[model samples]
Target: MQAWDDIINIAMIGTDKKQPDTISVPASLAEITTRIITGSEKNREEQFLQLASLLYNYQRCGISPLKKETAGTAAPVEEKKYCSTHAALALRDVLQDDNHSLLQYWLERCDSRTQIAPARFVPALLINGERNKKLRLLISSCVGKRGEWLSGFNTAWDFSAKQTQEEIWQTGSLEERQEVLQQTLVTDPLKAREWIRQTWQQEDAATKLVLLSILAPFADESDIDFLEGLSKEKSKKLQLFALESLRTIPGSPIVLMYESFLRSAVTIQKETSMLGFSKKNTLQCKLPDAVSEDLYKTGIDKLSSDKTWTDDEYVVFQVMQYVPPSFWEKTFQLSAEALLELFEKTDTGKKLLPALTKAAANFRDRNWANVIAQRRSVFQKELLPLLPLAPRDSYINHFFAKNINDVMDYAKETDEPWSMEMTRLILREAAKKPYPYVGFFQKVIAQIPVAVSTELSSYPVSEDQYSRSLWSGMSEEISRTLAIKNQINNAFTI
Candidate 1:
């Protein structure tokens, strides 16, 4: 028989160039090969095709692959804590669909209770972790031993890799350095501070501010000298960073400096109103009885030209922001609640409320945030992040009856999941008012877990065709979205 290599050789040049296969025949194929090689039974190309067909038939029936040595090693089975089915399904559903809001919820649950997600979910989590920096820690925690093993294959997902923290600090990009610095501060604040101190003068203004901002967590009187030195810098941004860091450590010299400056200009005053017995006396925020030429230049002096408020009122608002919110409680001889309430009664309180709430949000005082929510219809948006995550699933549980869009905006800003009660509230309101965008409502609904929204499955019932048509269409969208989610739930671990 002709060798297979000889057949390949004739095929390479094509029948047009040379007809080696047609010119010669193997001993075994001498009879049929003679017909194609010498006979006019088929032309050169046709003859080549017939030869190829015979080989194909022979190989399928005759050829057999030899048993060979084993291939590359399988990935080691990681022994790790497996998440519950509910948790696993929840993670998969949110992750696969790009439901960031719910993914945030899932990550939070994993973080709070040390829940490890399924191995299958790790790869996707790693991919997503590269997309959003904030989720890196939570994703790392959920990734388990197997996921860590997988991260080495992709540089983007290497957040969990252990390296010389100093290397990252010295050579990493600004974002990379900040991430390393944040972790360093958590583990060893002194080392973090030293790193900043070494690079302080060498770094540019933007980098310097970035480094200074992360110092707040571990800031103390020890950091005061460095910050004070920064205060002397010509860059206003640099000086602002120094002042902000100083405010974190209440007893720091910088805060004390501001405190001393304000001690004389601000004081508590009680006023008596003789109009009615019910309105006898209440405290008022009082400024200096007399103003001197020195007062106007310092923030201690009233300084705004706008008629909306007095110069003294404007100055007090500015001073309240810098000083600790606690200072007012002691200065006014009122508790935080009473002080905030007393301020609410005055027009000056309305102007100053934002500043005081800012201090509260910065200091992470929940009491201050709550009291603001109590008295005012609106609270500072920044305060929500200072609140804990994965709050028993229903903490921000109800949507206010009015201001549906505002409530939704607040929910998104906080990155917290809306409770089913809240979702139901939104749907019920939509059924009544018919929210303008069906697609937006559909997307938001998809993020909510099927389990949580079980009771809200059926909604917006109506007899009128227009109203009925709208509700029915929205219901169908929810149905289709949840049906796919249900399929995923069945297909997934939890």
Candidate 2:
């Protein structure tokens, strides 16, 4: 070890500046170190390399094992039943495939059936739960007494161990601490806020970002002042994050301010036809001459990053993105459909349309989502999840023929099981153009209902050799995944 330390010091000082003759090895290693240094005719760099390699191996190979201790008490007997063999095998397949959604479904089924994972699978599941904090609670519930007992031996698996929330908050890993904060937020948000407030200054930047993110979903009037305070912090990222979180809270002062600004900055201009029979409404956007101190304080920038829009248009876009689409509807006294129509006619509409679309998705305004879906524009794919099942399915089906890739994207994003009709449509499209859809087949495979697995064989095969090969592989994977899912479903049947 002394020789190793001396070698490091020499290396740090550089071979040219210091020689390797100064290395001091233990009596046991001295002979080997001397031979390595003088074994051949070499320069200072070569002598240092030989000495470093010799001491490195000596230290590594000489490491002493800890004194053995007797094993602790045995794990307590588990009252819970083990999952079915079929279910365990399905789980193994899911785990090996690294399919998170399937794993979630399996855990849910295992927990709901009052069965714990097989003892052999407990470690893997616990390891997964450690990596993905969201799964820890579910995994803890399903891993049973044995898993908890196993977790006692490994510090990384401490999430499965019995510990008070306060203990976990103080001493747990970042993931574990986050899980605790998330749970605390649900049970006692004020306490959670207090905890973050107490530690705000001490936490690192990364920790601060994650902890602040956890507050977003549970953010309310209580968090407004704290978030507003964060919005003014020196870190631009934290400032933007705080502002975004504040935007989610409907009546937050920042959102109210944005709404107020937009109410004046944007408006509807109505015009009657020459015959006075028809009326028309156009969106009128009044650009601000300069960015105000109030706007800058709320994290809005003065300059435009977007080449297409001016600084004013970009500022308006940024402000409108935070204000809920419902605000525009209420301010202008128009339906979502009518509003979209007006936005379509305006020169500023291109910049603001995307903003309104984002606001609809962010606020989860279903009415706005419905109107946005009607256009079948770029925004439709983003808002597909917010649309009702019937409309979403209809939209995908209508657009499938013209643009299969877009339909695939919509399906992948929603991650919802396609209707039987839509499934048939997908198969028909794949049969025609198997190449484009092949890559996405595995991703959407689980979304295919089990009943449709039987229909895979009936689809027409592509004539092109490359396309046929792709379809064959994709169809087989779909069948296999569906079969496993079916087995998982049936294994849980009472």
Candidate 3:
């Protein structure tokens, strides 16, 4: 195994030197060059010249050496011919069967450019996985220059340039540098965060805003300090965006952060209502006008019989929903019943109460389930009767229908009204499923009472019933059973 591994590793490196993996190279130089040229927008001429010059210098004898020549004389014909000859030789040496030679040559040129002696550094920050301080310093130089160099690469360079670009981000401008920082942070989050901190104050407000925006992509608990600082901004927009960013760091101490802010600036009060709920200790905080408006628009309608809300309000309420139940213990101790009553009175009791209960349940609060159950009971009792019966079982409404199903789960505790309703649905569904005991369905059919069989005469019939006698000889019991089965089958088919 060891010998095989050694052979495989050796095959990976261009030299017989053992390495890790095979490189995935772009198919052609024209493709890579086209990507570089078309993808870049900044310093186009300079970048182009820089790339061409680097390629030229790295090519075998491609560059004409500056050597002693007769002053004011163009008599170095031999040298020019030799330079072309060597360039062709170098091209052959570098390009022949080399998959990643383009990147290798680029790195060699970069190393030569930064050399102080025979010893020189290359763009090995990503390649060698080294923490050499010079590599970080070089990255800083790129960032400080506003990431002007990054535009020259495209998706085709993702493999070769990915690491070097990321390392350079440690030095890249805070706002301009986020593009590079994005790739590295996923693999080395702690170091990426530290890099952000080292340059935090040096970045301007706009740059800070851009840097914070990326927090949602790769935020962790360690980012709380940076977020807290940004959240305290005097600008409302910045404060909102910062708060929004903190939301991405799930299970973090964001609520404590939010609570502190609310305590300083906002208050919530409860209003009396006919629904038997009135309490002053409501959870309240004022977001920016837009967020507040969004919450209001998304909250369940106060007058809708459905008692359901849209998805956006739930997202706005998610911060409270994710808070550990223990955090609410103090409130529970003060007046658990009062809090419960307030939840019932809230406009979105059906939606908010259940979520609030579940979140509290995580802390072993027994009342969480009890409170949600109580609200659920009122909802089932009051609203179940008004739900429309779909002519067919719809896939889209399956979940909502399921919720109602749970509320009215068969054989559970129920009054006559509910029992009667379920019996009707069961008969209707049973008929569709071809259940044999169609005669046993008298309870539901009797309640329907309109004599659907006789009523068929008053409705439109086939122009010639004699010829359309599809069920002419069937007994009443068999005919009724077949009709019910057909209807139920049709319902599900739709």
Candidate 4:
């Protein structure tokens, strides 16, 4: 230890200015550090290497007491079977990069089979969790109790939220406690809400909003009282969140409040265009010159006329936002499918699609969700969370088939592995698309499962100008990703 400390002191000043003198060492290590420490006195890099070798000697010789309590045998191994050595390697590759959706492929497999991640994976996973917040739950499931216990010792790995729920909740940092709440919300939303209420007064405005936002999906009548109280707050964000919370709960008072507004403000009065012309019957939205105090009090932001939407159009949107999409079915006298078509046709439907999309996602409206999801022209990855956890890759697959960006977007949304068909298409697209596609493919290639690499290479690209120019920059990136994947496969081959 003394010799190790001496090397460290000299290294701190660096060899550029300071060099280690001949130092005595243990009779055994004297020969070892002499050889290691002798020749590399030229520069700081050399001194650093010499010092590291000496420290390794100290570490090798220094063993803490065996009697010191072992991390009481790993938390009971999960009943789930351990994945095959091969699957674990695939997972290691997935976790090595930001492939949350691909990682889900492993997580869901373990979940479906009641399997656990091999214990060897916990250290790397713990590091992965530090950088990507999304990985923690999946990591927790795979690592089970063993990873939870292991994470606390390494500062880099310590953020794993699988253990010490109470200890972390009470004493961990704000982010830590928030993670506990998210996990708890999944298992016990009421409990999470009560916990939020217990500490509600202490959290800052941002934290309070986040806490409230957590209640979005599972929120019920049980949440209404607290959320309604928040809706009355002065801050617009707090008020909006409260309104959103209320909106998620079907037929909550806030929903009814908006429903009543729509009842009074909207009508289907039929009228003929000019005399003896075809009827101009349609959904008509009316707004009073002034809204009731109660309506304003309930956190409805009054609309100022805009060029795109009349005051009536804007008010109708706010009203529909709180009203459940199902309510629109009755109000408009149209089925969910019909309503989606209507949104495509009418000026008002276009205005209302954004509001309806939020409702469709939040209220878990299956029919509207399907229609809106299919109709969505661009990626709405956020909705993936609100939808069912089961594989929706078939739906995402349609989008991925159409655009390269879609390939990038949906892969991050769920844990489902790419279908063989999707893999073929991506390979074909990558082979033909020009240089700009190179940048996106390079990052995403690491995410492609190793199982696909053999097939990926088998694809035959035409020697056309576009394809040639495309693969020039792109193939190298793809090759790099595949090489790393091979390394992971080889390293973990047991």
TM-score of each: 0.59, 0.72, 0.28, 0.62
- As for TM-score, the candidate ahead, 3 or 4, is 4
Candidate 4 residue-wise lDDT, 1-494, digit = tens? 66667667766886677655446466766676566556644554675576577667677877775542655665655656787777777776766665554455456556555667788887777776777665565666677667767765666666654546767667766666777888898887767777888988888788877777766766888878888888567678988878767776886876787787777776655578777668744556678666677777765667756788887778777767666788878877878877677565656666767877776666777666666666663344445544443334445556665555755566544334455555566677767665545566544543566666566556676678777866755665566566665654453344
Q: What are the per-residue Cα lDDT tens digits for candidate 3 across 56-134?
A: 4434353466654333443211211111233223323323322132223322333333421111111222222123222
User: Against the true structure, whose TM-score is highest?
Assistant: 2
Model 3 earns a TM-score of 0.28
- What is candidate 3's CA lDDT for residue 362? 31
- Candidate 3: stretches off by over 4 Å: 1-166, 170-180, 202-207, 217-221, 231-236, 245-254, 257-348, 354-494
Tens digits of per-residue lDDT, candidate 1, 1-494, equal 35455568768977787664533444666677666667686788787778777665665676676542332335456555677777676666676667554465567666666667887788888888888776776677777776676766667878755446798788766877898899888898889888998887789988887777777756777888888787678899888677777666677764565566566655545555666445422334456666454434333445677889777677766666666778777666678878777666667676777878887766667766666655553455555555444331223432254445665666544434455655666666666555464666545553455754454446655566787777667666666566555554453333
Report how far off residue 230 is in candidate 3 (Å). Answer: 2.5
Ranking by TM-score: 2, 4, 1, 3
Best by lDDT: 2
Q: Candidate 4 at 49: error in angstroms?
A: 18
- Model 1 whole-model lDDT (C-alpha atoms): 0.65
Root-mean-square deviation (CA) per prediction: 10.2, 6.4, 27.0, 7.8
Error of 1 at 199 (Å): 5.2
